[model samples]
Target: MGTITTFQTTRRIVMGAGAIAKLGEEVRRLGGKRVMVVTDPGLAGTGLVDKVEDLLKRERIAFARFSDVEADPSYETAVRASEKVKEFKANVILGLGGGSAQDVAKVSSILATNTGGVSTMFGIDLVPKPGLKLILIPTTAGTGSEVTPIAILSDHHEKLKKGIVSQYLFPSVALLDPELTLGLPPSITVATGMDALIHAVEAYTSVNATPMTDMLAMQAITLVHGSIRTAFANGGDIEARSKMMEGSMLAGMAFANAGVTAVHAFAYPIGAEYHIPHGVANSIMLVPVMEFNMLGNIPKFANLAGMLGENVAGLSAREAALKAVEALRQLSKDLQVPARLSAFGVKDADIPGLAQGVMKVTRLLANNPRLLRLEDAERIYRCVL
Candidate 1:
């Protein structure tokens, strides 16, 4: 018998080239009087912050800004953002930028209404109360953090990445403006686009996958497969950018409901320990993890080959499955994604430690279609090493 599953997303999702123009009205509709805009220094420097500030000014909305968000945000970052939220007494929190900024805003918004730090709420569904009204805007085409009920924060003291998963983390709105992504460099475009691909593939092959999630994941896969290269090569191509952005959001919703498997399970550890960007870490582990998982679900992988636009008309399921793995490898190669862990400064001796760190994230591993034992985890890390 198939397991029943429930799909959930933000209350509203707005996407398009000029979608960001609706930000002020959306905040007003949410009954926000004072807004706290959480973002990062890089984005602040790029004048995107000025663009958002202008929108707020036009709407006559009172707003405060916090631009200290860091990549792969730390637990302390959440607390600091939360403190600023309280200081401004902001009734709404607007997260602007990529995954890290969105994560900081999500945690900070929740912590503003709840008790204790993000540490106390690690693991699944640990948030005890609803948070202030929150809206998320993604300037990059990855890490659908806008739609997911997940916030990943690094714990510096422990040298590990932890996630806070709860319905409370879902933003009130997910605003995706492809115009905002026009300036993304090719490398970031590749890394983030692949991250979305991983989300869709992992979710489709997850133990918790359902019909609805599969529908969403497959479309996301198709969209990403069709548009990633164009989007990477021509950052200003609005059509390509729009497709990637929508695909990323769908992938995010897919994984949020169906759960991610070993790829993400392994990524958290690598990202936290090495200070790698989350999307890049996922890109690094994606091919090896998919190769490991292929044998566990050949038919699904075969279908994936077709979704990824591989020529599999005359191939058997098993043959097509191999094509899917090859397709991922070729995509990564073409994108110039680092092919080995050594590229990230990880050594062979680090496999065991990475394995041990992965074991801490069984919440994700449990959803792997194949059971990833400790030995298997070590072996996967060693293969990539």
Candidate 2:
């Protein structure tokens, strides 16, 4: 018999153009009077934050804002954010902005009820207590951190990114307002949309993928392939933004359960050691990893090619599988995503150290359909150079 699998997501998802209007009502409905909004400096004084504040005030829900989160949030940032949560005596936690803010909120929520530093709960299923009621509002249509049972923090002491995976990390609600992403700049739209694509691709090709997750991943891939360009070209188009947001959510759900593979495994170290954005790192490694993993599951790759809109008619599975890779390259080129690690200041001499770092993320590597040896990891990094 096959091994049984489990999938999870937030209890409630409120999605649409005007979903932010329910922020306060959702908190109140969940019996939370004091809410803590965790976000990053990039969003601190933006009208978006002010708009949320206004909504909370209109509903008479008292709230506190902590805007100290940074990209690839550090353990210290999470610790300090949790202190704010405790100081406010907040019964609810709201994560606003991108993945970093959401990750901080998820970790701080755990620290609110669990008795320890965030570092103590680093591994899988280590969190022992239920956290405060949590609501996540994603300003960007990427990361899907709002819906996942995972939180990633940069461990400065260790000089690598670490993840906390636990059921307790799942939020009580996810409020996805496509309107919030209207003003997103083109570069972010490209990077984040590619992030969503990677999530779906990795999940679909994961060794742990199930029939359920495959369906979700395929739908996500199709949506992203069809809508990312439109969204990138015109961020204000609600239709395009809505499709990207929905696709990103589905991809998040798929990966959160099926797990991501080597692309993410290799990307983590680049982000941690070099301060590259997670999405950009993933984008840089995407093609190389896919090429390396192609032979491991040719049929699946062929299917992916079809889903990505590559014409596979009259072609062998192996030939068609290669098209998926070319399609990805074309998409990256169209979006002007940097294709070389050198663009990010990484050198050929850095390959060995990065390969070693990739080994440390065995949790993710073990799920790759193609087993990645140390030498192969080095080669992947070099190929992107």
Candidate 3:
């Protein structure tokens, strides 16, 4: 008998050119008299945070801003944010930046009600109750943390990335405003957009993929591949920005259900050790991991060429799969994202330990199309090095 599956995403998703205007209404609709705005200093500097605060002020909603969210936020960072939420007595959380901010928001929401340390909530379905009402708005077209019921926090003590998976982690609403992404610099555009694209690519190829997840992943792959270039060249192009943002949300939904494969598994170790940005680390591993995985499922990998806008007219499945790899290579070249660990000062001696780190990411590795061994992980890192 076929296995039964379940799909989950944010209950409400609001998307448009100027959707930030709806934030006050969304907060009020969630019965929030007090709100916490979670974000980072960089986005706060962008004045988007000011605009959100203004909206909340106009609504006469009491609010507190937590703008210290760091990249790869730790469990302590999450606790501090949650403490601020409790201090402010916030009833709703407004997550208004990229993955780090949104992740902290998700964790903070749960931490407020779930009476325990963050470490206890690390595994799947561990949280016993639902989090507070949460509204996440992405300022970058990446991560898709707004839609997914998964959050990753840096375990600084262990020097590894850790995740919390629970239905309670899903936000009450996901607000996508393409206008918010217009100010992203080209380099970040490449990195975040690539991250979104990789999520879909891995989702489509994951062993646990379902027809429902594949549909979302396919649209994500098509939209991100088609529009990332245009979005990179013209950040102010609302159309490109809209598609990229939507693609990211769809990819998040796909991976939330289907899970991402070895690309992300390979990324976590380098990300934790070298402090490479998540997207950049994933980009570095994409080609090599996909090359390794395509042998197990060439037909699925082959379809990626056409989905990514490459012509695969008369080629064999294996050849078409190779085209997909070449397409990623060319895309990385065009976007100028770093494709080597060597750029980040990672070297030969680091490979074995890093490979060991990759093995422990069994959550993601279990979804990899090809079986991965410790030796295989070492080889993948060295090739990229």
The estimated TM-scores of all candidates read: 0.98, 0.99, 0.99
User: TM-score: which is higher, 1 or 2?
Assistant: 2
Report model 1's TM-score to 2 decimal places.
0.98
Query: What are the Cα lDDT values of the candidates?
Result: 0.91, 0.91, 0.93
Scored against the true structure, residue 174 in model 2 reaches a CA lDDT of 96
Give stretches of model 3 more than 4 Å off.
none
Which is the better candidate, 2 or 3, if ranked by lDDT?
A: 3
Kindly list the per-residue Cα lDDT of model 2 for residues 191-282, writing each as its tens digit.
89999999999999999999999999999998888999999888888999999999999999999999999999999999998899998999
* Candidate 1 per-residue C-alpha lDDT over 1-385 given as tens digits, one digit per residue, 9 for 90 to 100: 9565578889899888899999989999999889999999999999989999899999999999999999988989899999999999999999999999999999999999998767789988889999999999999888999999999899888889888999999999989999999999999999899999899999999988989999999999999889999998888899999999999999999999999999998999889889888888888888888888988999999999999889999999999999999999899888888878888899988998889999888889888988788898899888878
Best candidate, lDDT-wise? 3
